[model samples]
Target: MRTLTERRLRLVGVAAQRAHDRLGRYPASAEQILVDYQGTTRSLIAESLVDAWGNPVQLKAGTSFDALSLGADGAPGGEANNADILLSELLASSAPRPRSPEFAGLQRDLADALHLQFQLDGIDYSHAHWRNSDLSVEQIQAALAGKPIPPKRHGPENHGTEPGADVSRADRTDTEKAADALFGALSGDSMLAKAMGFMMKMLGASSQARAMIKIVLADTLVHADAILQAQPAPLAELMKVLTVDRNTQVIHDLRAIIADEPETRSVAVFYGAGHFFDLEKRICSELGYRHESTLWVPAITIDINETGMTAAQLKGFRALMRRTIEQQLKQLD
Candidate 1:
């Protein structure tokens, strides 16, 4: 119920804002925001003025307009789900949505690197990137204050607490599901998997072989990492869509919240580790933030013996993968 109301508020409010801009005055009512307002097809209809609870949205016209949804109770004041929702507040909260320059540069650089790497390694680097997930300002503050982080809606369609934002996320989620299915089907026979399998065998081998292969494999894996940094699988293009592209909005929202709350002394952004590199650069370069400290947490752990490879073979196989990956990286370089 609140979800539908929020969407209408944003979409209808945006149309109303456009109408206001052209006429230099607020619309007399919600219905005055037309489908073709300012040559944009917002698809708004008479129903756009109707709130989720079947109450008409209250529109007060002035130099600046105020729109209101009377909540589930359809009354002036209430609490919880029945609380009043103000359109001005909603728009103000999300007003700082323009993409920052640093975000744009980082995205371009990553895409270029991925394209070049794919040409050489025939591997997708897209999965190497950070995945996008929402963490609200209130959640971060709660964590900082030693309180429990608030629970958020979880699943494919609920990318954000606000219903308006979920529209874009839904499209992204669909792409991600398809990409994941494709990635799973190809991973078994993929060169990366074979190389990893071989490496596991090397890890189980004798110390002498381990020592030699470790040095060589280390050098090779470094190069392989470079290749992984450069390319992403075509189907996994959704990885970039989910990780890099969606990050722009997240960063924009964070910046807005920060700006809106001038008294805030500290803010902690929580995201996948892969995202931090670019995010740090953006915050420092664009938002006038400085580096403070670092905390590392292990996200995953793997045991080599579980792969069912004997020691000697595992050592040799790792060396082979390392060398092959190194050569590929060198070619790209």
Candidate 2:
């Protein structure tokens, strides 16, 4: 019940912020927020304008706007569930100023959204793809900060060795070898290669497709894991270790950080996009966070012309892949 109220108040705060952006100033009151705010949905006004206790939320408009909920009591102050909830304090809005004139418009929005997503006052956590125990958090931080990455404790030189090399061959799994072969086939002059290249180009051209692909991949992993049971496939096990287990550890750390450091205002979690759905749910449900915004950045792009496939060829290939994916999903179900 308390969690639901906090989430609703967070949405109200988001609406107020959106109103500020559109109006060139914050709304004068909560009532104004309900009436004047333009959000992604019309029902947001009804859902956000009041607290869970059925009391009208109060808006404290000063130099900065704050959406206030007096809590379950509907009074100024009280204890336990009746304690005041301040939206301003709940949301993280302290983003750094743009460094240059070029950082205007979309770039500025991305920067602000990222800062708003995670405001770190105490400890910040980041996870890298490598499973090496030697790749410490400090090392990851240094690498992210553009410092020279320190050598791995055990086998830095072994990385990226020729596939036929004894160490490399021994280290490579069947799944990794198959992935490498699939990638190798993409450069061939065969019809399948051309089709695959066109599909890659199509994905690069459409951000929505890219996002949907991530969702599909995540869903497939869940189904695969369930089907494999105790004897899971290599890819599913690897994904569980990399995405699921790692996310669990990160959430545990976040929980400890919040509990130990009450003054900590913000927290930044740097993780791959595939891992976000579960992590976001855990944070919002367990740690009392509410989703406000998202900033999308393309990781890969390919020119369609470079693929040497005609428009018709591309369209046919895309449809084929879509049908194949749908069939596979149905089989999984």
Candidate 2 per-residue lDDT, tens place, 1-333, comes to 567777787777777777776677888776667664344344656676788888877877767887788989988888889988778767665454335432133323322322222122221324352232323433332332335545434444332433443524465565454434443453334466556555655664654555444444444554553443333354454455445555766776777777898987766676656678778988899788887755333333334565456878766766676666667656755
Top candidate by TM-score? 2
For residue 236, model 1's alpha carbon misses the true position, in angstroms, by 8.0
Displacement of residue 263 (Cα, Å) in model 1 is 4.2
- Residues 307-332 of candidate 1 have per-residue lDDT tens digits of 45678876787778766776775675
Error of 2 at 293 (Å): 0.8
Clashing pairs in 2: 119-266, 119-267, 120-266
What does the lDDT come to for candidate 2? 0.57
User: TM-scores of the models, in the given order?
Assistant: 0.33, 0.35
* Clash totals for all candidate models: 13, 3
